[model samples]
Every structure is written in structure tokens, then in C-alpha cells.
Target: MELDVHKPTILVTGGAGYIGSNAAFLLSQQGYQVVIIDNFKHGQQFYPDWARVIKCDFSDQSILDQIFTHYNVEAVMHFAGLIEVGASVRDPKIFYEENVVKVLKLLNKMQEHGIDKFVFSSSAAVYGTPTKVPIVEEHPCNPINPYGNTKYAVECMLSDFSRAYGLNFVALRYFNAAGADVENGLGERHKPETHVIPLLLEAAQSGETFSIFGNDYQTPDGTCIRDYLHVKDLASAHYKALKFLDGNKSAVFNLGTGIGASVSELVNMVTKQTGLSINVEVKKRRSGDPDRLVADPSRASTLLGWKPEYSSLETIIADAWLFYQKPDAVLYYSDQSYQQSSVF
Candidate 1:
């Protein structure tokens, strides 16, 4: 579907973290009037000026009311929530409140203001322990972890709200969100980073050893395999999802390259990209582990006309390396002369 081509006001929640900011930046470039809502807890480090950024916690309904009033928000691309899996297990309440309740709050505000077009950021975690390879949209959702469960729960809520209140929504279930925007404008910069691409990139740049979680999975590499989609591609999927939300079409689509890479395979990719040898120590596997999780994004392609461009591992690593040295992590480090990751 072609965009409206007329710049219209759109609200973006969690507009500071990796994907949201990139979306905002690209939206602005596409001539859309964008408004951002983000709590600075995780966004302070990488906030973007591509849109009118308004910092507020989504749990506060009062604040959402004020924001909708202030911005004349036409539509919303919701990305506000806690995202770490292990951390979600430790603190499920925050995830539930932020992902579920806050979503309802946002919808209430949207309904009150007579706004309804919503593009939600859901996750493949919802398809926890899939019954088959290349999980489809129809796969049974049994999210083993709190993070996945919360996402799945919110998807249900959105579907219900759409039925009950005429809420036009699109839920994009994304796979491993990796890579930085190549232009160094917007990229992943999670604090105490847990993401493999950014974490590996940081370790390589800082000259530190990255710990591998385990090395005894059923994959050929003896490590867990994951489909690593570049963050920019993820943002583009959001863009597609946003455009897909027309006058009367609510949908759900998976965003992925439909391929899996093991942890060691990723480390080797980084090594190959940087031409630098890295150290890794394998540890015990975590409890909620899926041997191989790859998504079949046929629906996204068929519905949203979305397909990943940076589907190669080398491109992901090379682009990420540029962002790390010049943009994303340059301010965080003390030493500037080092060209590669090693013990400083």
C-alpha cells in the first residue's frame, strides 16, 4: 500500500530505544509530523530529534491524556514497554503494567481523542517453543517467559479492543532485532546491553571478552540459533505496518529474515567482519531456551509489502561496527584511539 503522501501527525511510544527512534527519524525524513513518548530510564542515552519528543511514562493515564491533547496525535505506533527476557522473569509486574495496562491506557486516550490507527510492537516470543520449524502467524502461542507472555496478552487485548471499540490496529511480531542504522543516525544502544549484536560489537570495540551463554544446543554449531533482523529492517517493517493501517484494515504480521544463526556463528561473523579474533567462554544454558526460532514472514510480505533488505550477517556487522565507533558508543568510552575490541 502506498503512503498517504501527506504529512500527518503520528505519536510514537518508546521513541528513544533502538527501533522506535529509527522509525521516528525515518518518518520525519518521509515528511510525517511525528510526536514521541518515551520514559528516559532507557532512552536518555539515545533520544532522537526527528520528532517532537515528549517524555512520559505510559502507566500514567493522566499524562497520556495531556499528551493526546497537546500533540493532536492522529495515530500511534506503540513501542513503550520493558523488553529484556531474563529481566522480565525477574520483574513481571513492570512488563505487565507497561505492556498491557499502559497499552489499554493509550487506547483509552486514543478513543477519548477519537484516534484509532495503531501499529503495535509485538514479539516472536509470543510463539514460545513452537511446535514446528519456521513458526507461522497461526502457531500456538505458549510464551514460556514473562516477556513473551506479556506481549501475547497485549496482542489479545488489542484484538479485543479493535472488536469492541473500532480500534484499527496492526501487531508486528518481530524476531531478533539486531544491527544499527548504517548512517549512524539511529541504532541500538541498550544500557548494560543484553542484545547479541550490540553486546558483541561493544565487546569487540572495547577489547573485552564476550561470554557465550551455552555451547550444547542441537544446532550444528552446538549453540542456540536465532534469526537476526537488522534494526533498520525492523523499523521499516513498522513503517510498512503503519502504512498498512488504512481507513479499514487491521492486521498482524511477522518481521524476520526467516533464517537462524547460532551464537558461535554470530561471534564468527563479528570476527570475520572486523578481521579480529575474539575470546568466548561457554556457560550453562538458561532455563527457557528454544533450540531454533525462525519466523516465516510470508504474511508481512503479502500484507504489508515488507521484505528485509539487509538480510546478510556481514552487512549487519559492518554497519553496526561503523555506528559503534562513530555514533552509538563513542561517547560512552574513555579511550578513543583503539580501532578494535581488545583489553584496554
Candidate 2:
């Protein structure tokens, strides 16, 4: 399906970043007019033609006014924020300001504009080190790191807004988001990348020494275990959340495959899928590193009728390996008419 000129617009904040870009592309394919707001802080330059791109901070009041005024935005899918866990631990001020304070500004603008529907990009990190195997939505949130705390703070704000102002929203708390939308030319492009799969793929491709972080954890292989969900699957859930707000009150869901893969296992799988060897180096475990983190993901399935189609370990690695093989074709157009003016 293509974008219908008569269709209501969906404003996607941070829509040029990893998960947001994939979701934006999927929304475009589903015939929604996507208006993307991104600052391009990560140096991600791949902008698709399907969406109108606005190069600015999402919290910019002048730009927000223009966007809300120009487009008949039905809802907002916010994915723009600082996401590095280690960095968040290093300087918490930036994390809180970028992730929490800035988002408050955006929400204030949304409330002013009467655009009450929101689909937030939340994180499973909010559950911290889970007490059980698969974490459920009701899991107690005890975030050990600043990153997780920021996400939880946002969720709390959304909850408050929902109750006080009738702001319908869905906060999809995600496990690990991996893989690429190879068909749509979308892939992970984080600068100084920290994600496991991408780092492993780069190690395999370049024969670089990939540190295992720690091998003394309580898990089977002693490395940390995480639930890796495909980016495409995450994108679909965002769309589902958007549709869900059409009738339901505010809700939250965990998005994952309910499967766990250890770090060593992921390394081995990278070798298996890429047919290349990674120079392995074991190191001290980073502080706040958990033994395991997996999601029950039953609420999303039961509530939104959403399921993960490409979250299997095999499919995740396969798609990621394919994405690592080539350079991303820049889809940004130089024509001014194709870009949304950020100027007030």
C-alpha cells in the first residue's frame, strides 16, 4: 500500500534512528503519511522518500508548531532520545535531560495541539535485573542504570497524563531490538556501535577482537543473556499500538520473543551465520550488567493481537548478517520540495 493523500498523518519523532526508521518505513508501506522529526545526532543519513523528513530537535517549539499546524497528525510515535546505557551511567544529567525533560516538552506541545495519542519507544531495562526467567508487564521496575530510569520516568509521566488528561497512549517496553529491514534498506548505523549483534557482525567481517565482557556470570555460558527481537517485529508492534489507541485507554506491553540467548551463544551464531571468525577477548563485566533479561510478551499478543514474525535467533542473525554486507544506500533527496522545512 502507498500513502494516500487523504489519509491522516502520523508524526514519528526520532524517525531516522535505528528502530524509528524501520517503524517509519513500515508505516509508510501501510499507507500512513509519515512525517519524521529527527536531529540526526547519530549521523544516520538514510532518509526514505516515503516520509517527509524534518531535520530538527523534536522538542523545538517553533518547529513543533509548524509540524502540528502543517500536517493533520493523528498521533505521535516518539523514538528520539539518548539510548546508550554505559554512557548514561557515566553522565546521568545528559540522559535525564535528553530522555525525560525533553520528552516533557514534547508532550506539553502535544497536549497544546490536542494530539493526545502516543506510542512510546520504551525499554525492558525498566525491569532491571528481573527476578524471573521471562519478565511480564507487571514486573517491578527497579532500573539499575540511568537509561532505564529515564524510560521508566517517561512511562510514569505518560500514565499520569493518561489519568489526568485522557491522553491515550501505549508504551511498548522492548527487550533487545536487533536485525534490519533489508528490504527497505534500513539497518543499524549507531556511531561507536554498542549493540551485540552489530558489534559481533563487524568483528566477524573485520576480524576485530570482540570482547565478551565477562564469562563469570551465573548463566550456562557465564555471559549475559538477552532477549533479541527483530527491528521489523518492533516496527509492526508500533503500528499495532497506533491502531490500538483507536478504542482502548492507555496500556503498556513487553515486546520480545520470550527467548533468551547468551552472549557466547550470539558470538558463536555470528560465526555460524557469517562464515567468519571473531577474535575473542574476555574482559571484566561492566557494572549493572545483568545475568539475563527476557520478556513474557503475552500482553502484547493478547491485547494488540501482535506477534513476532522475525525475532527467532536464526532469522535475527540472518537478516543482520545480510545488512552488514553492504553500504546503506542514502535515500535522502536533495530537492527542497521533498524535505519539510524546519524553519519557523
Output the number of the lDDT-best candidate: 2
For candidate 1, lDDT tens digit of each residue in 76-102? 998878888888988999888878877
lDDT of 2 by residue, 1-344 (tens): 13444569999999989899999988988988998888889748545678877788889898888778767889999999999998998999999999999999999999999999999999998988888778989889999899999999999999999999989999999999999887767878888799999999988988889998899999998999999999999999999999999995789999999989999999889889998888999999987788989899999999899999998898999999988886765555443332345543
Q: Looking at model 1, which ten-residue stretch has the lowest summed lDDT?
A: 335-344
Q: How well does model 1 score by local distance difference test?
A: 0.78
What TM-score would candidate 2 get against the native?
0.95
Stretches > 4 Å off in candidate 1: 1-7, 45-49, 70-72, 327-344
* Candidate 2: residue pairs that collide: none
Best by TM-score: 2
Error of 2 at 201 (Å): 0.9
Flag regions of model 2 displaced more than 4 Å: 1-6, 332-344
lDDT, each prediction: 0.78, 0.88
